[model samples]
Target chain A: MIEIKNIIKSFNESTIVNNVSTTFLKGKTNLIIGQSGSGKTVLLKCLLGLHTPDSGEIIYDGVSNKKMNDSSKTLLRREMGMVFQGSALFDSMTVIENVMFPLTMLSDKNDEEIREKAEIAIQRVELEKAYDKLPSELSGGMQKRVAIARAIVMNPKYLFCDEPNSGLDPRTSIIIDKLIQEITKEFNITTIINSHDMNSVMEIGEKIIFLVDGEKNWEGTNKEIFKTTNQSVTDFVYSSELLKKVKKYL
Target chain B: MFYLSDIGKYFIMIKMSFFKPSKWKVLRKLIFKEINDLIIESIPIVAILSFFIGAVISIQTALNLSSPFISKSLIGFATRQSVILEFAPTFMSIIMAGKVGSYITSSIGTMRVTEQIDALEVMGINPLNYLVFPKIVALLFYPFVITISMFVAIFGGFLAMTFAGVPSEAYISGIQMEFEPYHIVYAYIKTFLFAIILATVPSYHGFYMKGGALEVGKASTLSFVWTSIIIIVVNFIITQLLLS
Candidate 1:
């Protein structure tokens, strides 16, 4: 489990993530949902240690980020995995090589052992046929799967996905969402996804934190989201006409 | 002020790149790959350009030394001196600043735009150590390329003189005249320094670059410009310090 306490981040004089605190439970898909420019990415970057918060503590299990030195932080990062929005696979590397990269760099395992592990992760993502294909040869959905395989090959304690569904079709988005949820459950990892996709929010958001501007405006489950009377939440959750019709039925 | 901060950042980047080095095994593979990419692949262009330029320099020298009073060997001597002292080292490096420098920038900039650098950081790897250090190691062999350039260029000069009906013996003797070995040393020193600039300045631009595909192109242009400018400036300074 990861606990955020009073995290405040700013750029220039304007705050991007105000003193927002939340708990992301282990073995659950924790979603941070907000509109564009609403601090979702900023908050996610803070969690990933890509951006340092001006004030507050992010405690991984019991260790606060403030207490960890650079090496310690790096060590901690080894236990974490990230799937970027663009699926950030190394363009020059093939699927299996991409998945095997972290192991090749960080693991003490022999080549055969590393290959076996990478093959297992590839199989898990159902991308065995694409083992030798470069990222450019893969489709959008296949690329995201490769990214997921690479992220999970290390068996991280924490998983972070930054808009994993962006640019993907609706069907592919759901599959990616379900895959992440399943991975979170199977690994019992603390999975935090930064997204604005309402479908993802409803499908895999076991714990949802809603941000308006830089502050948390609402916190609830998907079921709770539909029933909540909060004006801003309703306005966002049912912003679309199709969603409004669905909410009317609900 | 922006330049000052960027300069400071460049130093800091170099410092950090040496920190927390990657595993030697992985770095070994990366170094070999970079050597193949940056050095071996560049040989054809260097050889071709040197040959043509050397031929031109010899031909020009031969035409200018048509006076019966001037020794015909002076044409070969002038060509050899010009090739070794300035042309091979300075001109070739300026050309590489366009070729190799832009390549390093665009490749790394593409990585940045695509977030591959971020991915490395997330994996607890030092992106600089993983990416830049190998390039530096690979380019340490750059003098090998320069040496080839020097030999091919002198050979082109020899061939050009012979084909132009100049006495081959006179040209060969001229090339052997007053060979100050220190000039070769000075040229190599410049070559080595240019190699470092070729690797680092482009890397700095690429690594720190922001934005998308268009920005990557912009960074490549910027890197090439900066690299060429630095090479020329450094060449002037080294020439003044050593030759003068």
Candidate 2:
């Protein structure tokens, strides 16, 4: 479980992530949803320890992140996996090598053992033939799949994804979202995804935190999200023309 | 805000720079990483110029001493002195400033502008330790690698003169006659210092870059120009001290 308390982050005169506190449950896909420049990414980065909050406490499983030693923090990170917006697969590596990177760098497992685990992770993602392909060789959706495989190769306890469905088609987006949902439950990991894609919210938003600008506006499930009378949430959900038609049915 | 901010900034920078890079077994790997890269990437251009400078310096010596029956013993000394003391260290560093330095700046700058560095940080990896340290470890000792190339290059001229059978023993003597171990030793020292400055400044500049493609290009250009200028200036200061 991860708990963020009074997280406040700002850049220059503009506050990007306002003072917000939230809890992410283990064994579920916890989501942060907001429009562009809404601090969803900043919140995710703060959780990852990429950006330090100006003043706040991020307590992870009873340990405060701001107070942890560097070694302990690194150990915590090794137990985590991330899929960045662009997939961020190492361009120089093949899919298999990219998946095997964390194990090679941080694990005591031998090459044969790492290879076996990496192969299984690749297979789990249903990308059977992309093991030898470079990231550039794969299509955009395929690259995200490779990124997913790499993220899970370590069998991490925490999975963080930044806009996993941002550039994919609707069909592929559903596929990726389902993959994350299934993997989250399978590993019982604490998963957090950042996105503005409403289709993704409806498909797999088991838990969602809505942000307006930089402040937390509401918290609810997919069903509750559409039912909320909050004007800002309505604006966001109805802003999508498809959701507006869907709103008529609501 | 006005007067001594630059000096104060340098002091703060010096203090922050002291976060002794994590001691890791990875540094060994970094050394091998640098050696492999330098061998594969840098040798062809360096090889082409090695013997050319060696020959030119030898020719210049021969031309200057050709008039009178110069001391045969002085021939090798002259060859060895000019090649080892001056051309070997200075010229090779100049070449490296172009080839290896530009390559480092371009690569790190591209990664910076592309948000790849941020991705690494989000993964809890120190992009500096992961990306830049290996280059530092590599280039720090890789001057020795560059030095090895220089040994071949700066002596290629003497070898050619000897092969041409122009009283070669005499040329060898001219160079050997004035051979000072400290001169070449200082040469290696100067190159080693240049490698550190070259690796750190450019990698730091690239790592902190915030803008887009044009800004990345600007960082590379700035790193190269500043690194070159520092190398020349430092080289002059070292030469004066070592020679005196």
Highest-scoring model, DockQ: 1
Q: Which lDDT tens digits does candidate 1 get at residues B45-83?
A: 999999999999999998888799999999889989999
User: Retained native contacts per candidate, as fractions?
Assistant: 0.86, 0.40
How much does each candidate deviate from the true structure in C-alpha RMSD?
0.9, 3.5
lDDT: worst 10-residue window of model 1 chain A: A241-250
Residues A1-250, model 2: lDDT tens digits: 8999999999897899998998998988988999998999988998888888897899888899877998888888877889988888877779998888777766788889999999999999998898899888999899898888888888888899999997899999999999999999999999999999988889989889999989999999898998899999889888978878987996
- Candidate 2 Cα deviation (angstroms), residue B41: 3.2
Clashes of 1: 0
For model 1, the DockQ equals 0.88
lDDT of all the models against the reference? 0.94, 0.79
Worst 10 residues of 2 chain B by lDDT: B14-23
Instruction: For candidate 2, give the lDDT of residue A127.
Output: 88
Candidate 1: regions farther than 4 A off: none
Candidate 1 backbone collisions, by pair? none
DockQ, 0 to 1 scale, candidate 2: 0.38
Candidate 1 on A59-82: residue-level lDDT in tens? Answer: 999999999999999999999999
